[model samples]
Target: MSSSTLGYLARRAAQKERVRILYRRALKNTLDWAVHRHLFYCDADELRAKFDANKHVEDLDTIDRLINEAEASYEKWQHPDPYIVPWAPAGSKFTRNPAPPQGVEIVYNYGKEESD
Candidate 1:
């Protein structure tokens, strides 16, 4: 009901969002290193366990500190060359074949006789 309570709620929501984003990024980064789906699933479980270990912490400062540490670790261990979809930006097939130039007309002939 009070302004302090509202501020606390907002901070908590923001922290939760940051944690969610961090978890997703970490999982996606893990995929870059695990070449096989089976291995990725195992790694994913381990990563989940690590996050679950800290899920019970109620201190906001502690949560913030953990988040910062996780982010730093993520940056340090990120893959140098992550896999990208062929059609995605920076991929080999990205924009490889662009559309034809504007005002260019393409005619399709179906059994039409040519007149000289």
Candidate 2:
């Protein structure tokens, strides 16, 4: 095979790997939203269908464009922080049921005392 053919194959293989990674990340994120095995199956199927729907594109440019658009959509929609804001009301674990400790004393200030 010609060098150009080998280069094209290499680029295609890299793009395929990228798509697989994106799909897996999307499925894991779906689990975060689904919260149940059954729900996740349904979500995964829907995601699979979205990719399957575009399986017939012969043009490399279209495939690359679709992959990029899918990736952008994934990045735009997915939530980064699963946990609640640390300082927001009802957010922290301690805030859920805050109470005084059984026994404790302030041994030292968090910061050094000022000379003044």
Which regions in candidate 2 have their CA more than 4 angstroms from the true location? 83-116
RMSD vs true structure, all candidates: 2.1, 9.2
What lDDT score belongs to each candidate, Candidate 1 first?
Answer: 0.94, 0.83
Q: What TM-score does model 2 achieve against the real structure?
A: 0.66
TM-score top scorer: 1
Candidate 1 steric clashes:
0
Of the candidates shown, which would achieve the greatest lDDT relative to the real structure? 1
Candidate 1, residues 1-116, lDDT tens digits: the string is 99999988999999999999999999999999999999999999999999999999998899999999999999998999998989999998999988779998767777787898
Worst 10 residues of 2 by lDDT: 81-90
